[model samples]
Target: MGAVNLYVTEQYLLLKTVDTLQQKYGFRTLFISDARDEFLLEKYDRRINHVICIRRKTFDWSNQLKQDIDSYLRKFYQQPQLFRGKETRFSIVYVSNLKPVDSWEHLSKTMRLKGRKNATVTTYFVDEYEGLEELGKLTNTIDKNDNWKMEALPPISEQERQMVYLEQKIVAIHQHNQRKFEEIFQFGKTKWTFVLIIINLIVFFLMETQGSSTNSLHLIDWGAKYNYAISEGEIWRFLTSMFLHIGIFHLMMNMIALYFLGEITEKIYGSKRFLFIYFLAGFTGGIASYATNDAVAAGASGAIFGLFGALLFFGLHYKELFFQTMGRSLLIIIGINIVFGLAVPQIDNGAHIGGLIGGFIASQIIHLPKKTEGTKQVVAIIGLITLMSAMFLYGSQQTSASENPQTMAAIAQEYVESERYAELIDWSTDRIDQGIEHEFVYFYRAVAYLETDRLDAAEDDLFRSIEINEDFAEAHYNLSVISERENEIGMALEHVRKAIELQPANEQFKQYEKELSQKSTSG
Candidate 1:
């Protein structure tokens, strides 16, 4: 009877400690048995990704305790789906009422030899055991006598009744956790995700109708991100380019990613918040791309990555729930995509990373639906504004044409279209001096020199352009013209033959080749 009473007191204390650990210390229920004799609880410090495990059981021998600990460690390693960390730092807390017959020194040595480098096991015995005082301090069970409750308890089997109560408490905790998880996603409806998808599809089809979406000139006309245009104060391209795409395949991929990511983000953040996050992410992503790249870029990749950032923010608030639901898979997918982007030279990873970080910052600015952190949100908003401003200022200051040939080429093309030969000559010369020794740059300058009647300079530049790019049909054709002017029919025929071979479908090359052949035959 006295043993039964002690068991009852210990069970009650165990239940109270479990409740306190969950409610106050933020521990999550990991495992619970129907018999309620044993259970496992875990707590994670989300900030550091550290984990603590608490196990409850009765062990009659030190070896039994050691065996259980070893088994649990095996299970932990085997079930990678249960957690995501490269090297998890695990601290296992073992709680029991019955003391082992032997000292734990041998078991401790065994654990040290076999356990993971960062794993450790600590034992605490309750109810008339040596570790009771230390356990009391940890669980807030000191100086509190729950033994009095056993006397008022029903005259039923004490252990069975306590087990039943413990099971009920565990069930209630699970129910509470489920409710909280459900509540977080219930605040918003998914509207903007679908709407954005429609908008992107519409824009893609419209862009195709205007001309080919793959055409750089057409893309620029339809508001793709062109660095030279942006540098010329067309800042609105940053926002508009997100709605554009480089090709049908690029559009399709982005829309697919957006459909899935947008739905979840919209449902979590609501339409207004989703819009804020999307645009902010896209804008920052564009700026980041602008700062690092001079390519004519377009897509919703930045905004899609921003959605990734938004979910990351959600995880920060509800770490345990996030891991339980989509954390592992999300992290794996993000890792794979990032690695793929790095390996592929054409991928705009700058935009991806920028949007990810921007989306996180944007989420911080708006916070959750009903939650408000006044100072934190304000700081986030200011910080984002300052960061974008700095990036924009830095990008604008990078004026060396040698550094961005695509932008320089675009500028040269603009001059060519407007018949500004003098300006083209001066601009190309400046670029050439700055080490911008591209085939197109030399060809454009040669054309300008030819227009100004500088035949020798034009011929020299044409030869240099062909030397840089052997497949430069335009340079070859122009060199043939210089040879023809000097009455060198054989050299002119040779140059025109190469031009015609390079561009078989060009009527101009064919016509020039025919003229050069006739001149050679007449000579």
Candidate 2:
């Protein structure tokens, strides 16, 4: 063959190799040079991530080989770095028609050395210009001697037409991949994310303004997750508690997490799906907290964790994209949060776990944007309903005033706040009959008795409360009220003094003290 024909054969071989790898082996085009001599293609699966670099031109080992290798590494590193950091394992193939030079005897050894730094490199020289048995090793699909045969070089005009066809194919593949990426990661505007953040901020401000959120009384009033309240037919607490935060610090941490997680989740899943996942997960968390904990709990942590679960769902569908972008880091972050929650006693980890599971199930039910799987979605919906029903039933059965002092206290305060005196007395009487001897239970019952003009019963309960805790300032003040009603001026004076001594800053106690002193002097 003439020199011109030899060069044409090389060009034809490179084009043929590129087409076979893409059309047969499923490698997508990554980057192609403007001069049509060099290109990059990648094939990724659950098992491996691979990149192939091919060029029509050849270079001697002592010439542009080192520079070309550096350039490939630089470009290869950029692809991964754009989505995620450079922590994933890399395998690169350098292909050309150059025969091995005598000075390049140590090349394979050098590549193996670089493998220690988490990258493996291999080079193939297409000496025969027609076989791709070596390229098949990368995918393990092409057997030896199963070569792809090509026709002899055609006329110059025909060769030019073939080259143009190859160029168009490359451009089409590249454009398709870009569109797929955008469709997966950038589905819609972050409308619900911002709306949710604003709603949370408004609720937080409302809680802060209406009696401090830190107070247990205010927390229950604001619809914090109080198990006893939920058992009392207040099922809306599950949803309302998601909007009520415990404190300013809790609100800030959760809102920040919500902002970041919600932005991506809404864009990936669209606004409506994101909202469904968020609320369902939050309700799950609230119920989980109700079943596992008897304390007053409130925050957006559960809903934010649901957003994490949403991303996890996305990861299941797009494994390569997730790992390449935020998979490893996201897993590490979740692990750290779980560990931290376990280490800290105050953190509501039950809600976090419940929200995560709920978010995943909700995502399964909704599926991803522009995709549908009816069977999985139906199964997910059924599973969620069953799980939530079981949890709610278990939580209801677990509620016992005798077993949980916090629940007893919450029940007492809730009744007293609403001034349900008669109902308060009946509930406390039933609990007392069951041997529940909590101080708040006795104190609230005394308040109910006093309000209903049952002075003797009120006095008896007051003494019981004072006996349980001698520093019960409110109990002492109520006892003074009973004594004054009986016209025992000296007894009223003594109890009022003790109440003022216990709580010196209470204006109510001070004013009562003055009235009792005046009565004692008049008598």
Which sections of candidate 1 miss by over 4 Å?
Answer: 1-27, 30-80, 85-168, 399-403, 406-476, 482-518
The TM-score measured for candidate 2 stands at 0.72
Per-residue lDDT for 1-523 in model 2, tens only?
6666566666665776788779976777767788777877766644545567777656666346666667766776556432233322333444455644646534423263243454556655553444445555544523244545445557766766776787788778888988998998899789888888899899888878877877776787888888766887899999999998878888888888998899889989988899999999999988888777777889888889998999999999998778767787789889999999999978989899999999999999998988899998999999999988988888887875434776577667777887888889998997787676778889999999988899999999999988999999989899989999999878887898898899999999899889888877877
Best by TM-score: 2
What is each predicted model's overall lDDT from 0 to 1?
0.75, 0.78
Worst 10 residues of 1 by lDDT: 141-150
What is the C-alpha lDDT profile of model 1 across 1-523, one tens digit per residue?
A: 4766656656665665566566666677766666554556665453323344455567778888878777877777775544544334444555555668778645533133144554444444544355455444443321143221212334437556766676587769877876776678766788888888888889989988877787766687889887766877899999999999888889888988898888878878888999999999999999988877778888999989999999999999877777766788888888988999899978988888889989999999998777889999999999999989887877776644435666566666767776779988987887677676789889989988887889899999998998899999989899989888888888888898898899989999898888878877877
- Scored against the true structure, residue 391 in model 2 reaches a CA lDDT of 84
Q: List the residue pairs that clash in candidate 2.
A: none
Q: Which stretches of model 2 miss by more than 4 angstroms?
A: 1-13, 33-38, 55-64, 71-105, 108-118, 123-159, 401-403, 406-435, 443-523
Lowest-sum lDDT 10-residue window in model 2: 81-90
Instruction: List the candidates' TM-scores in order.
Output: 0.64, 0.72
- In the order shown, what is each candidate's alpha-carbon RMSD? 8.2, 6.8
